[model samples]
Target: MKYLLDTNVCVDYLSGRYPAVTRRLQAAAPDDLRVSSVAVAELRYGAEKSVHKQRNHERLDVFLREVACVDFDRDAASAYGRIRAALEAKGAVVGPYDLQIAGHAVSLGLVLVTGNVREFRRAKRLKVENWRRG
Candidate 1:
C-alpha cells in the first residue's frame, strides 16, 4: 500500500517520539513511501522557525531524500478546489494547506499517515490512517 506520510507523522518519526511507527516506517518498502508537497512545506516552515534550525533542516533534507515528494499538479489543485468547496458547503472551515494535502492524497490514491486525524477527518473522502492509533 502507498502511504503518504503527513507532517505530524514525519515530525514524530524525526523526533523519535513514536518508535513503533518509526520502526514500521523504516521496515516498509521504500517504494511504498510518499509525501505530499504540503508536508514538505510544513517541515520547511518548522525547520526555518526552530531553535535548532540547522539540525532540523538537515533532518528534513534526509527525510525528503528518503521519500518520494508528490507535487501539487493540475489534477491535485483541481481536487483541492473541489474539496474546499465541498467542506465549505457542509459548513466546515477547513484550512487551505490541509485541503491541499487531502486533495493530493486523494488524487494520488495514497493513504495518509498522520497523528492529527481529526483535522484531516474534515475531508472524509481522503483515506487517513493514524499511526499513533495503530
Candidate 2:
C-alpha cells in the first residue's frame, strides 16, 4: 500500500524514537513511500529553529532523498478546503499544516502514516493509518 509519512513520523524516524518503525520506513518499497511537501516544510521549520540545526538539516536532506515528495497541486488545494470545511462543520479543528497534509494524502489516495493519530482523527473525512497501530 502507498503510505504518506506524516511530519511527526518523519521526526521520530530521524530522531530514532522508534527503531522498529524507523526500520519499517527505511525498508519500505520506494513506490510505497512518500512525504507531503507540507511535511518537508515542517521539517525545515523545525530544523531551522533547532539547537542542533546543522545535524537536523542534514538529516532532513537525507530523508528527503529517500522518500518521494508529494507536491500540493490544484486538486490537493481544493481538497484541503473541503476537508477544513467538513471538519469545522463537525466541530473538529485541525492544524493548517495537518489539513494540507491530509488533503494531499486524500487527493493522491495514499494511506497516511502518522504518530499523531489523535490530531488526525479530528478530520473525520480523511483516511489515515497510524504507524503505531500493530
Which candidate tops lDDT?
1
Return model 2's CA RMSD, one decimal: 1.4
Highest TM-score: which candidate? 1
RMSD of 1: 1.2
> Please, what are the lDDT tens digits per residue for candidate 1 over residues 5-85?
888889999999988778879988999999888889999999999999999999989988898998889888988899999
lDDT of 2 by residue, 1-134 (tens): 89989999999889988886777887789889999999999999999999999999999999888888988889889989998999899888789999999988888888888987778877645677766543
Off by over 4 Å in 2: none
Clashes of each: 0, 0
| Colliding pairs, model 1 | none
In order, the Cα lDDT scores of the candidates are 0.88, 0.87
Where does the lowest 10-residue lDDT sum fall in candidate 1? 125-134
TM-score of each: 0.94, 0.93
